[model samples]
Target: MNIRQMIKENNRLQDAMTPDNLSYYQDMVVYIRSSAVQERQCEELLLEMARRLLDAQDKGKDAKDVFGNDLESYCKEQIERLPKRKGLSALQYHLMIPWIALTWFFFVQAIVGFVTMWAGGPVERMTQVRISTLILIAGGAYVLIHVLMKWMKSDAFKPEAAQRKISARNIGVYVAITVLILVAGVWLGRHLPVLVIAPWVSLFIFLIGLTGTKLLFSTK
Candidate 1:
C-alpha cells in the first residue's frame, strides 16, 4: 500500500483501542511519524504496531507490559531496523506536498475570479499578486508551518509535558516573522510585475496539478 493508505489503515485500527491504549498508541504514532524515518517505513511500522496492540488488548493485556516503559528506546530501535534513505534518496519523490499546495493555490484564485465576476468585475483582473510576492508568501508559509509542526511533535512522547502554552516569547517570534514576511512581500509586489493570472489559466494549472499528483503520490 502507499503511504497515505497505510496511514489511513493504521488510524482506523487504532479506533478499536481502549482510551488508555489509544493514548499510548498515539504517542508512538506522533513520535515516529515526526522523526526522520522514511514515511513509508513509519506507516508500515505503525500499521503493524496497531494490529499488535489491538490483539494484545483483546487478551486483556496492559500496553506498558507489552511495549515496556521506555517509549523512546522502543521507537528508536524500530526506526534503526527500518531501511534509511541516504542523502537525496530521502529528499526525492515527496512531490505530493507541493503539488497539492500549488493546486489549492490556483484553485482558490479561480474561485476568487468567480467572486469578482459576481461583483461585475473583469475576470482577467482577478488578482494582482506578483510572481515574487507569491514566492515570498509560499516561503513564509512553509517556514511558519515547519516551526509549528516541530513544536507539535517535539513533546509527543512526553505526555507528562504534553500540554503546552504559548508564552509571550513565542507569540513575539511568530508576530515578528509575520511582519517580516509582509514587509518583504509588499516591497517585492511593488517592484515586480503584477502578472494577473486569468481564471482559465489557473483552472488549467489546477488540472495539470491533478495529473502531477497522480504521478508523484504513487510509485506506479
Candidate 2:
C-alpha cells in the first residue's frame, strides 16, 4: 500500500485497541510522527508498530511492557534507528513541492485567464509574468520546504494531548494565503518588468509542470 493508505490503515487499527493501550500507542504516534522522520518511512514504521502492538495486546501484553516505560527515550532510539533518505533520492523527494507548486500555480493562472476572458476583465494581465510571479514561485518553494522540514519537529515538542491536527481553521489560513498570492501576483504584474507570455504559453508550461510532477513523485 502507499504511504497515505498505510497511514489511513493505522488510524483504523487504532479503533481496535484497548483504551489504555490506545492512549500509550497514540502518544507514540504523535511523538514519532512529530520527529524529524521522512513521511513514507514514518508511516511504514508506524503501521508495523501498530500491528505488532495489536498482536501483543491480544495476548494481554500492555503497551508499556511491549515497548517500554521510558517513552521519550524509546521514541528517540527509534528515530536514531530509522533509515535516512539521502543523495539523489532525497533531492528528488525534496523537489516534489516545487514541481507541484509550479504545476498548480500555472494551472490556476490558466483558469483565471479563461474566466477573465469570459467576464471581460483586463485581458493583458493573464499573459504578463510579473516580478512578483517569480517571487511567488521562489518564495513558495522556500516556505514549503521550511514548513515540511519543521512541521513534525514543531509538533514533537507539544504535549501529546495538545498536538495539532488538520482542521478547518488551519485549512482556511492556507486558502487565505493562496488567495493573497494570486491577488498580489496580478497587481504586481502590471507595474514593472514583465514577460509577454500568452495564455497558450502558460497552458503549455502548466502541462510540462504537471507531467514533471507526475514523474517526480511516481513510485519506484
Candidate 3:
C-alpha cells in the first residue's frame, strides 16, 4: 500500500486500541495480527503504536529521519514525473543572473552620479578631472568583470545565495530612498521657511515612499 493508505489503516488501528474499550481493542488487535497485511506494514504499525505509547508516557522524541526521508523520496518521485530540462533546474539562479547584471549596471550609474556631483564644484578644476577619471575607470571595470563572470559561469542563480544578496540590495534601496528624501528636503528648505530643519521636510516625503514600497513588497 502507498504511504497515505498505510497511514489511514494505522489511524483505524489506533482508534480501536483505546484502554476504555478493552473488548473492542482486543478484537481489533486480533484482526490486525491475523490479517494478510505485509510483515513490513505490520511492523511499521506496531512501531507507530509504540511511539504513541511512549508519547503518552512523556518519553517520546521526534523521528527526524522518517519524515525527512519520506519527503525526500516523495520529491524524487515528483521530479521523475516532470518533463526533462537541460542544465541546472534552479529557477532562482537564472532569475538572479539577470538581476546581478542589472544591479551592476545601476551601480556603475550611481558611481557616475557621485563623480559628477563631487567634481562639478567651481574651485576644483583638477579635482573634476581626477574624480571623473576614477569614476569612469571604476564603472568600466565593473561592467567588464560582470560580463566576464556571466560568460564564464553556467548557473548564476542559486536561490539560497541570491536570497542573502537580495537582502543587501533591499538595504541599498533604503539608502537610495534616504538620499532622494534629503534632496527634496533641501529643495523645500530653499523655497519655504519651516520650524524644523528644511531638509527634514523633504526627508519625510522620501521616507513615505520608501515605507510604502517596503510595505507593498513585504511577503511576511
Candidate 2 off by > 4 Å: 1-12, 27-48, 51-62, 69-94, 153-157, 161-192, 216-219
TM-score of 3: 0.20
Give lDDT tens digits, candidate 3, residues 16-73.
4335332322333343333345445554654464355435434333322222323234
Report lDDT (Cα) of residue 39, candidate 2: 77
Q: Name the best candidate (by TM-score).
A: 1
Q: Estimate each model's TM-score.
A: 0.67, 0.62, 0.20
Tens digit of lDDT per residue, candidate 1, span 16-97?
9999899888988888877777778888989888888888999999678678998878988989888764323334333344
Q: Candidate 2: minimum summed lDDT over ten consecutive residues — where?
A: 161-170
Which pairs clash in the backbone of model 1? none
Report, for every candidate in turn, its global Cα lDDT versus the true structure.
Answer: 0.76, 0.76, 0.42
Q: Quick one: ranking by lDDT, best first?
A: 1, 2, 3
